[model samples]
Target: MKKITLLSLLAAFVISCADKSQAPGAAPVPLLPVATVTNENTITDSEYPASIQGKVDVEIRPQVSGNLDRVLVDEGAYVSKGQTLFKINERPFREQLNNALASLHGAEAALINAQLEVDKLTPLVQNKVVSDYQLKLAKSSYRIAASNIEQSKAMVASAKINLGYTNVTAPVSGYIGRLPKKQGSLVSASDMEPLTTLSDVHEVVAYFSLSETDFINFKSHYAGKTIGDKINHLPPVSLILADNNAYPQKGKIDMVDGQFDKTTGAITLRATFPNANGTLRSGNTGKIRLGINHDNAILVPQSATVEMQDKIFVFTLNKENKVSKMPITVIGKSGVNYLISEGVKSGDQIVLSGIDKLQEGQLIQPEKSAPKVAQIINKK
Candidate 1:
């Protein structure tokens, strides 16, 4: 009987221990990855893809018909106002000028002969040596000769002006482009073919088109601010290129179109930027950034937020340390963090990892880890 009783007690002890292991009790809650709430009235700059252009681009064309003799400037050479850029063969122009001069000299000689005849006839008429009709005829001939001299003088002037066209000079101070009509090629004044191109690059203009909705929004936001106010009073503008590299110099809003494009429902705007170093070139792509204001807000890493069917959600830890789904309103994305316009507030512990295995009210062994500092700071 004693041996049987001892065996029963040992069996009962084992069963009790097994039952105790399966009993409902407190479990260690695994520390979850979380971020602290930061209050920032951050000014987020809006960036858009833009293009850089010159204030004025001029196509260089020959003014008179001739063969191109020499292109004095190389491709991409900076030229100054009145600087000689090309030299055409002046031999033909010189010959034409010589012909005009000869015509002028002949006209002067005829005028002198007519005047001598008029003077002699006037004395003869006064002394009754010549008839009045003869004197009148000499006067008429002198007047006609005088008119001829004036016409010849005009012709000579025009010829000299045309000859001056042989030396092509830059009309403006700018950078010159490649010679479209190379040396030894024939060019004309009537043709539209450009001999070369010149553009002022000390400062550049950026042209961009915005839709009506965007235009209205911009005007509504900045109704009372001047461009200088926008530059100094607001956030600084930044430029980005097609290669995705950010341009160092900042730009300002130069102008906005007066009329909206009806067909496209858009309005064109232009911005000017200093290009003293010629780094901001014409015909290059760029982007602009403008600042907008938002009030106190909560920000969270974009990775911590999940979207489903157009709804954004974030995992939150409850009092029992259980993962719960919470909806959030994303105001804007500042770099890598999403500014929560609503829904999430300060002092909320959020789950940053192991979101895949999480369920609402499900107990978890939350392993406490530091919030992503680098990830948050990178949003700046």
Candidate 2:
């Protein structure tokens, strides 16, 4: 009876195993949202940290030593070229000028006397009353007097220049910076600091740098053998101001450094922008936006990528609808997309959703998807 009961229990366990195998819930294929890769022209934009400066920058310093008698223009004023911005005490310069003039007048009187002596002796020598040697000595005296008058004239011209220096004027049209010296402050040519600075902001320049590798890559994209030709072919760039707003006018790359900086291993680049509204100034910080046009390029949504062990990968669906984790090389980043340089080609489909649940060689149900990738990338 015990043997019969044991046989019946064994039969029941076998039936249970058979039932489980015949059931419909073995392993489920996960349904995933996917995006189809397409070939298209994409203009990828990149931004670099930049410092802005006015086209012209001038330091306002005293050309001659003097007390600042009057501040003709206040700080932060818009000054035109040759406009008097500061007035030094003219009394001292005027007195020096008068002294120079007096010396010149005395030299001129001496010259007149010398000329009178020469004129008086010329006829006497002609008539043989005075010897030719004596007449020659009188003419020589007159020439010496004329030379003295020339030296005095030079002194007068120098004094005039010095007097003109008392009235400090703007060297170029621009906005004035801080004024270190007020009306009572004394300034001189040898002072370590400048009185003020002027910046011409009719146009502005943005300076930026690129790493050696990046510079090489940057030059490779443009069509040219020489750097000048490359620069000429370069398209216009854009500037983002400090306030995070795009400037109204587009700028061009005006200059490129001939060599890389030894210390930084980076090359400098400059772009110029028109400042019609006087918004940009020297010492302003901003960003320079450079663009590259890719023809028939393959782009992948960043959401489709998975990072593991310091590498990037995406799950590509095969003809059988089975997923295989494929590696990809990202050369650049755009708004929510990776500018794929290697690993994946055009027309490849990649999983865009349910990446966490994905596994190597996993079978999945793919759904056509257009994710909010750009929206997500921009927010980040």
Candidate 3:
């Protein structure tokens, strides 16, 4: 009887413990995934690839005809106005000038002899020793000699100008390119061959085109906002070359095309940048950026949204702490983010991660996750 009572007491204790373990409403509710909401209105900037260019470029050519005796400046050399760039062989030009001078001297001597003959004949004709026809002939001879002297003087002047042309000088201040014709090569004035190229790069101009649609949209959106004025005060422009890592200087818009292009349906634009350091070269390819306006929209991290069957969706946390799957519309995609246009508000808590095991209407505990900080790259 004692053994049966002990066994019954032990059995009752085990049953009591099992019943306590299965008590009502004691299971812990699991937490669901979550994320904070953000408004797309705050991010209203964009960037594009632009090019660097110069406002002025010129080609240098020789004006005189001769053998290129010497080149005064090397390729890629900075030069000033009236700077001598080349020296043509002046021997031939000097010889022509000397011949003209000799001709003038001979004509002057002839004129002196003819004048003396005319004076002697005039006295003879007045004294009735020579005929009137003889005096007239002497006078005509004197006039012809004088005309010859004048013609020779004019020829000398022409020769001197041609000789001066042998020394070629720069017409403007700028950097020069390589010589097209090497030294000892013959060049002509009629051909006017390009000897080198010079460009004024101190203030460079950038050339680019914009679509007609974008141009019209900008004009309509921003009234009284002239294209030139819109980009004028923003910031100095920058250039990114094909190989260069960064732009060397800041620049600004200098000109916008007065007329739109009819063929391409685009408008041409230009921006000027300071190249005091000579870092920017003409004919270089690079990128340009211009800022427009700000707008209100929706933005969300790519991870928070899941794509199923070509449809985008996000798991959102409701006020009841219940997980709900919401369908969303994406307006634009930039980098690793999506700009949402519908289905989410600024203050809603959306799930960023840990959504693979969640089910609809499942009772659970909610755990708050820390908001993710984003690095904003300003596009101006």
Candidate 1 stretches with Cα past 4 Å from truth are 1-12, 15-27, 30-42, 125-135, 225-236, 294-304, 315-331, 335-379
Clash pairs of candidate 2?
none
Q: In model 1, what are the clashing residue pairs, if there are any?
A: 30-365, 30-366, 30-367, 31-366, 31-367, 31-368, 50-286
Model 1: per-residue Cα lDDT over 1-380, one tens digit each? 99999999999999999999999997656556765555566555566667777777888878888988988999899999999998888889999889989989999999999999988888889999878999899889999999989998998998899899999999888998877788999888887778888999888988878787766666655536654443344334667777777778877776777788889888877778888988866789877766566566577777787888899888887677677798898866766777787776777767766676666787765455555433464554
* Candidate 3 or 1, higher lDDT: 1
User: All candidates: CA RMSD in angstroms?
Assistant: 4.6, 4.5, 6.6
Backbone clash count for every predicted candidate, in the order shown: 7, 0, 9
lDDT of 2 at 126: 85
What is each predicted model's overall lDDT from 0 to 1? 0.78, 0.86, 0.75
Model 2: per-residue Cα lDDT at residue 226: 90
TM-score result, candidate 2: 0.87
Write down the lDDT that model 2 would get: 0.86
Report the error of model 1 at residue 246, Å: 2.2
In model 1, state the lDDT of residue 66: 90
